[model samples]
Target chain A: MMSARKIIETIDIRKIYGMGEVSVAALDGVSIDIEEGEFVAIMGPSGSGKSTLMHILGCLSRPTSGQYLLDGEDVSRLNKVELAAIRNRKLGFIFQSYNLLTRTTALRNVTLPMVYDRTKEFTPEESDEKASRILEHVGLGERAHHQPHELSGGQQQRVAIARALVNDPVLLIADEPTGNLDSQSGEEIMTLLHRLHQEGATIVMVTHDSEISAHTQRTIHLLDGRVETVVKNGKKKPGKEKVEK
Target chain B: MKPIEAIRIAWEAIAKNKIRSFLTMLGIIIGVAAVIIMVGISAGTEAAIQEQITSLGSNLVFVQSSFTRGRPGQGPQSGGLVFDDSTAIQDEVEGVTAVVVEQYSSETVRVGDVTLEEVEILGTTTGFPSVRDIDIAEGRYFYDLEIERKQKVAVLGSSLAKELFNNESPIGKYITVGSTKLTVIGVLKEKGMVGNTDYDSRVYLPISVVFQKFTPSFFARIMGDSVRMIYVELDEDANLDSVITQIELLLAKRHGVSLEEADFTVTTQQDIIETQESTTAAFRSLLAWVAGVSLIVGGIGIMNIMLVSVTERTREIGIRQAVGATPNDIRIQFLTEALLLSIVGGLIGIVLGVGGAYIFSAFSGMRTVIMVHSILLAFGSAAIVGAFFGYYPANQAAQLDPIDALRYE
Candidate 1:
């Protein structure tokens, strides 16, 4: 049994890609639950629907049929506008490609999430202070005014991470966050994620590399649109077991 | 997102491709400029004509023969108004002030040994000074008795007197005109050309002298006693239209023709002004239609470029959405870009338009008046074009599925 506090819960989620003659099941009958303050990595081969699951968890998409409880609310059937509001307030996303606006300064990119955060309604000055703080936290304080092309790939990804954290979201979802980085930069990013996790931030990362997944507290592996196994790296609580699948 | 933030984003996009953006705005610039210049020149012409009409003496109307519109060769040959028609209008029509009749001929007049051939001789009555507004700079005009007695008296216009006597006062002196000697009674004041005809270059005489004495006997036998034109001035409280109707009815009855078939045309100063104004207005409207088409073309140009921009920025859009931007935010950003382009273009066009109007007036000597209303109208329509045309592409950008957009290569 896991902890009483389940931060994310999905009941028998099914996602279909086409219909009838050419139908393909992207994620078929998968269920998962996560606890607060957890660092987990989802791993799978290319056709195994790991990305589709990550998209659903990030509130970027919805499953064809499911019951998803994010912070204990059924959000699977929420409209796109409602999902976008939730994403702005509660979820932060880091994509594989950095995805920073090319012509904008790094500080502006960091402040972008706050621009759409209607619930918090941070004024420009307040948002600027928060963005600068996050940029310094990501170790790119001096590069705040530099455009994306002026920075290296690693620096751009650092800026993206700062943007994701600027809103103080509950769930930090990173989809192949270090996928495009050099080995040295990738290790450095993993160290940063580990540091964030130590500070009690809930993080869900998607990675196919076993060596990378080994650094997480738990590794959930998928095969043929189903959870193959859940590997624990030996930080077990009482009455809780690994490999729930 | 706030509008200023959206405007900043749009500015970045525009600055990325400056040349392309300017080219997209070219049509609007030309359209606005053409509209302003056209209206300016036409309005200026109307003002100038109105001034000329006011100078043509107060409450004046003109009567002339429309000989070309008469049945073929009948008008100039025999079918036209005579001096008797002026008398009839004066007698039969109410609110008559004075009717000045004119008869013109080219004749040789000798003051001394110098013989000036082709001196234009105008035969008019004593009402010439009052009705035609010609002042007597020296002596007096020929009176009614002089006209009735066919007296050989003449009034020299200021320029004609200068040419004939050269510093010598010719009043009360005898000048031989077409084999008949006439006493020069007055030196008329200067009146410059109203159009191509120089009103200051003619010599005035009594109508009886020009009709019964100056013209050859052969001309009298063929053309009979004919009058060239009649200038009529009205009383202060006269109803002009009613007087015109009375004159038309009396003339048609005397000439044995209906009003439709009458060879003479009566026109007031206002009538001539309206005809000229409508012509200029028609030309202006044509130019406006062309300018309007150009503006539409400019709007289409904006839509085309924006659609291309939307395609190019698909990845950017997806990234924005992932960072919690709503579709409305993306739409506003693109729309702002289009509005900026059009408004900036309109402003430049205003500068060009006013400059062009002044330059045209300077080079062509044609008048041009630029009104504030035209500027506002051009700019307002340009903004409307921006908003209207920008909607579709902005909506296309907004309605893109985030997942699919993100996956776009």
Candidate 2:
């Protein structure tokens, strides 16, 4: 494959909790890179710092010390306001709980991101129309006006995905997107993610289930706040290109 | 986020909890209402008193005798205002148009078979009609020539006529006061109550008639027809201050005393109105301070509820932050909710206050005047209170850690 542009690159990132002697390192000198259009999964047991790494990568939190570059621009030292702008313009997130605003209709939930979009790419009417179209594309055309409480777990997750995709983000981070759904619904969600990947959307997922991680092109396994192995399709990748300590 | 979007979000949040929101706004509602109503009643009373003073006459000055010199053990000094003072004011004072010497006594009056006790018997000259703004509904006022001859002619006020004669004409009828027979020469037009002075309840007579019938000849020789008060009318272009000074100097000379030792007090209509207005203004401010306390308590109510709302919606705030909302967006959203609550409450208060004023007047017979500025002031203060009290909770919500908020379940 031709060399791809790096969408995310973390250089020796470290995140410490508390201070002094009792300080705990959640991520210890970890470094990684994700190319454009890559489908990757982060796998780790509880207390392994996978959640902390997801937060840092999502721009929801900053590392204690490190260089994080998104689309080749340093974002590690940016303040909360600048980080929020980057998140609004370039990144999207889906939480494990499908955190849609309660009592809001599905279409409104999908249109929320555009409300904060500073580009003014679409008028309010156009935003509603686009949100409707996306809801149709997600196989919930008739349920656009239904609130989250009225929808099933699978449908709620689909609405969340529609919300995340509304801003045309460069990176989509899903933290166990199907964790709250039943097996059949989880299978459907996996199928939808695969279809999105085929359509050239870069996706990152954090999950504990091996079966869930198996669907990704590459999986990074973490242990004891460090990367334990990098596997490709059940086979180990050749070299650890950027892993430190 | 756009302001419109924040407003919409705030509306939804408030609409979700209708009872609590209304209960929260009750403080503002009562506070604004109190402010409007209290100001309305006080201003109305002031207006009524002002109208009462002005209605007595145009450019009028009142001179009433006051005891300025009296020993601790001895009887009061004999220097007092006499009926001659009115003639001196009319002749000597510049800009003086008319001077009316008046006195009153509570006496039993009998017309035909009807006798009314404690009826006010007023004695004055022919200028009483012009200077006091009184009009004759029928017949005519006692003529000035009648005062020289001490004629036993009288004018009946409209209400006194109604009490004595019912539907019969009181004109040319006989009314007896203190066993002295008098003919009713005129009946006054119906002039309603001005402050506590009811113009339509007194019996008017020529000044000499009252002095001849009520006072002993020896006392008259010494006191020279001593009167109760003098009402002086000035022309339209009169300078009240200079005219008042002239009257003061003239009275001092007539009483054989200096200006400081003068036994009479001179006052214009404006002075009376001003004294009443100052009193009402103090009362208005006292009511405003009381209303302000309730408004402050209302603001605290909003703050308390907003703090609770922020705590309750911690996870919702987290969701908003995850969706790219800045701290300011959250702050604006919550602040807008508080502002909307107060604005709506203020609107309701304005309506209720105005309506309540009218209703209170209708039931209690107290005059109430609603001023436009009071409503605006109440509404403006409500908005300010909402914003002032809303900031802390909104800031607390904005300062919340997004990750920890999300984990708050």
Candidate 3:
């Protein structure tokens, strides 16, 4: 019987920036394993390479030298078209800037990924319906027709999240998802990510705040293009807490 | 994305900036309208020229006497072939139908109560009306007997009659030509002006009467009753070249010279018509070229506006790109917007151009005609210009870097 795992492993991943004399290593010899249905957060300061590791894991960028097996398939050496396909099918991205089309409505923003996924056959009406439902799930159902400029920053970020989830991706990768929001809006977005994780969706988020990382079941700390440590929270095994303590 | 969604997005973008879109389309409108109007004017002028040429009778040929050199110090010297050359043509040419002789001189005339100013007086034979394709509106034309007897009879052109008799009929009344009193036998129908010359304001009489009464000394001193020119009518089935050759031979034999020194130039009316058509065709092509330049300028204007629009929407392009839109989508969107602008402008321009042509024709009394083929050409060229000029800007928009564009304010 096969194990139902959303991700397999990463081995000796290295990413270098620039070339020749001015080269800088953004990620060096980084490796980690993430299992199915886990909410993990990567914490690091500026220039610590957490964003570079997240980009490699999300298939947004390629590793200079590494092995990354996503669902037991080697994804490190994939070509551009194959990487795009993997990004479309398995990875969903939530940006810190909330890059929604300015003049377009929330529903249209949500339906954009489905437009790029040409192999999936859905009529325009069905796509719109699915976009509307996802917007509703993100708590922007009534604001489906509102343009990005008309919505608040937090509401716009939620719309971006809805757009990412509309493809039903297996791994949700967010980079500084709530960095630009107020405390209340940031907490709300984290709660939304927590709820999505509880529904058996695998999530990997990058942030600089320890308090934000505390909401996840596991935290990975990185320093100077290397992973410092990985810590599992006590809640992962509530029944064995007394024995372990 | 579905085509309908792209169209909707384009329309929304256009609606957002209505004034800018309209301003961009104005160039196309003016270009198309200018093309239609210029072509209409040329067509009108060509039609007018053809109508005038046709009215002069296409089958009639003119034979004018040529003069050899006389001394420069000689006063009022005259040398030309005589009326016998006309008779020779009639007798020798197989295609000859009717030959008429003409002598024209400006002379003062008088009636009962009014002494008219100097006007053109044509002296011709009884076959003048048939050869020139003119009709007598009232009374009868002079017969051959009248020409042979040297009777003083005249036919008044419609305007000449109006000038001499007012509203009263002038047939049978006498009008003085130089010193001879001639009786009016008929009134010619009204003929409009051609090439700014008034043909209806003239009088006609027999060549015999004019030679006997007005210029007796001049005619007697010349070879044999010489006149200005002779007009010949040919059978419709006869070859014009053969007839011309035979007439040239007869004229050369009669004038005692070779074909080159025959002292006459014979020209068919078809030659005049052909010359006029080519001249008008040249003018029409010139007008079309001027209009084409305007259309090119309009195309450049579309390109300028599209470049501006692409620059203005760089951030929007970046946002779309970030949301997984391919470069193709960006290209198609901008191209569709430009196409819609030009097509709508072209349609409006066509309507205005046709309306302008009709209005010009009605108000200015110029015959303006709009051809269907010209309209199609204008419309098709406008679309091609739209595509050609809109392509570069749209490609520029499509090739923009998403990362750099997002950084643009």
In terms of lDDT, which candidate is strongest?
A: 2
Q: Give the Å shift of residue B33 in candidate 2.
A: 3.5
Please give the TM-score for the first chain of candidate 2. Answer: 0.93
Which one wins by TM-score: 1 or 3? 1
Every model's DockQ: 0.58, 0.61, 0.27
Q: Which candidate should be chosen as best, given DockQ against the real structure?
A: 2
Candidate 1 per-residue lDDT, tens place, B287-313, comes to 777777888888999999999999999
TM-score of chain A of each: 0.93, 0.93, 0.92
DockQ of candidate 1 (2 decimals): 0.58
lDDT of 3 by residue, B251-305 (tens): 7666666776556778887787788788878988888888877777888888899
Candidate 2, which segments miss by more than 4 Å at Cα?
A235-245, B67-76, B91-95, B110-117, B176-181, B209-221, B224-226, B235-239, B253-258, B360-368
lDDT for each residue of candidate 1 in A169-199, tens digit (9 for 90 to 100):
8889998988999998888888787777777
Q: Model 2, residue B267: what's the lDDT?
A: 90
- Best candidate, TM-score: 2
Q: Report, for every candidate in turn, its global Cα lDDT versus the true structure.
A: 0.85, 0.87, 0.81
Greater DockQ among 1 and 2 belongs to 2
